[model samples]
Target: MTTQTQPIQAYSLPTPNGQKVHVMLEELGVPWVYHRIDIGKGEQFAPDFLAISPNNKIPAIVDPEGPGGEPISIFESGAILKYLGLKFGQLYPTDPRQQVKVDEWLFWQVGGFGPMLGQNNHFTLYAPEKIPYAIKRYGEETLRLFRVLNTQLEGRDYIAGDYSIADIASIGWAQSWERYGATRAEHPNVIAWIERLNARPAVARGLAFGKAS
Candidate 1:
């Protein structure tokens, strides 16, 4: 007997992390219902949402047809991308070595690139009083990370192998390079990759969500 899968219930905002899942779902053509959690209004701290996302973050999902046919709630953007990829048999490689390549870049974004860039953004834009030290510190780190990514994309269209979750994980954060005090001129390969990903209809549609309609 075949068990039916239910539409994924996604609670998210339009931030970079949220966009990763949204774009992946769009690219995979997975059935999902999007619930916009307004972080500014503290909706993420609500009892219901907290139960699903213990970390009180956006981009959480409840997959009713999870492993063993049990409903499962997953938090963190990277985990969500991997789960969807594995379930849909798309956007992720079946080969062991190829999977490692994708996983490395994905983890790099989660651990190093995203945090550095986020700190740069906070100091540059949202921080009420800019400490020169903090700004310079994060800004330089962000640029260094950009250079690493640019080198990685020297001849490849995507980060790991093909257009996998690794690219999906990084694109949203890379899109905010301006806020991180980086420029396209310094990272031509990254710019080209961004354009390539942006050209996809699914990516465009995913980006359009949560925008004023």
Candidate 2:
């Protein structure tokens, strides 16, 4: 199967992780279809969705035109972003050094920023028993991570090089700054970067999708 024969299938919702892929696909201008996987409804654990996303997560994708012209399914939002970058030759650098720079921030988000912020969200908003220790721990960590990001963007327009996948990865996570007990006023550089990316038409369109429809 080739992309010409079938559209990319995206299983996701409006969450930050899901928004990452949605924003990427729209930015790449790829032909794709969106299938809302209502995680709140436990649809992520359904057998069919599980076959593609063993972790039972949203933001999985099925590409008809995979490497060697075969269909392939991918999970993990970061991997999906990299796959689309490699496939479309966009938003990622070809040079190994530049690619590494991009990967550094991308992985930073996947490994640190996203998880900590997610924990902060859980403790601050959804946790039935509001554990002050858990909330403070994750909240402080989220702020620390934001400071690191703000420092990284001190003079640059993006986290890594030239608005690549790294920016795409970080934006969704950073969007929850308030919920994570942080403020844009304290992170000027990050706020500037966020505004810059938010102004993009493609990004605006992607962020608008899968929203309570």
Candidate 3:
């Protein structure tokens, strides 16, 4: 570790899923060094990375300076965003009702968008061989999730009326879906939303941090 007087130690890749936390840290203006965990080569399944996250997923972190000097390690991308937002009380609303509104959308991405699009990526792109049933199944499911987001975003600049963790979780998957054959242009409002998100220099940097992006 190149010593820094910062609290966060992030293990991640450059993909949208991993970049979500990086974007959060940049948006929060917190100093942290990123230790890249390349899932492309199965580095996430290694013993070292497995120690922190048994599930072998990207975008995990450990904060040595967590509350009361307790070292905190966390996994699951959405949970990480939720923890950071509410713990810092910055990206999430303080008002209870507004916060729940954000929570609902955030949870939607965790439960719906990520999984659906991930399956689409598998069936449409990564599967060893495409099975018609799997392709149709995931493709339809992915499109359905997109329409839900498009309708929800009908009049909103950001999810929950402001740029919150809900936006983080949703935008991460949105970018992935676009990469997996879903054109943003098909959903005008979603295209506008992506442009708005890309306009952020921090988001751009965090995204570009991964050489592949």
**Candidate 1: lDDT of 32?**
86
* Regions of candidate 2 where Cα sits further than 4 Å from its true position: 1-5
Candidate 1 pairs with clashing backbones: none
Candidate 2, residues 59-169, lDDT tens digits: the string is 899998898998999999999999999888899899999999999999999999989889888898899999999988988898999999999999899888598999998
Predictions in order: lDDT: 0.89, 0.89, 0.80
- The per-residue C-alpha lDDT of model 1 at residue 46 equals 100
What is the Cα-based TM-score of model 2?
0.95
lDDT of 3 at 132: 98
RMSD each, Å: 1.9, 1.9, 3.3
> What is candidate 3's CA lDDT for residue 166?
88
Q: Stretches of candidate 1 above 4 Å error? A: 1-5
Deviating ranges (above 4 Å) for candidate 3? 1-5, 176-186
Candidate 3: residue pairs that collide: none
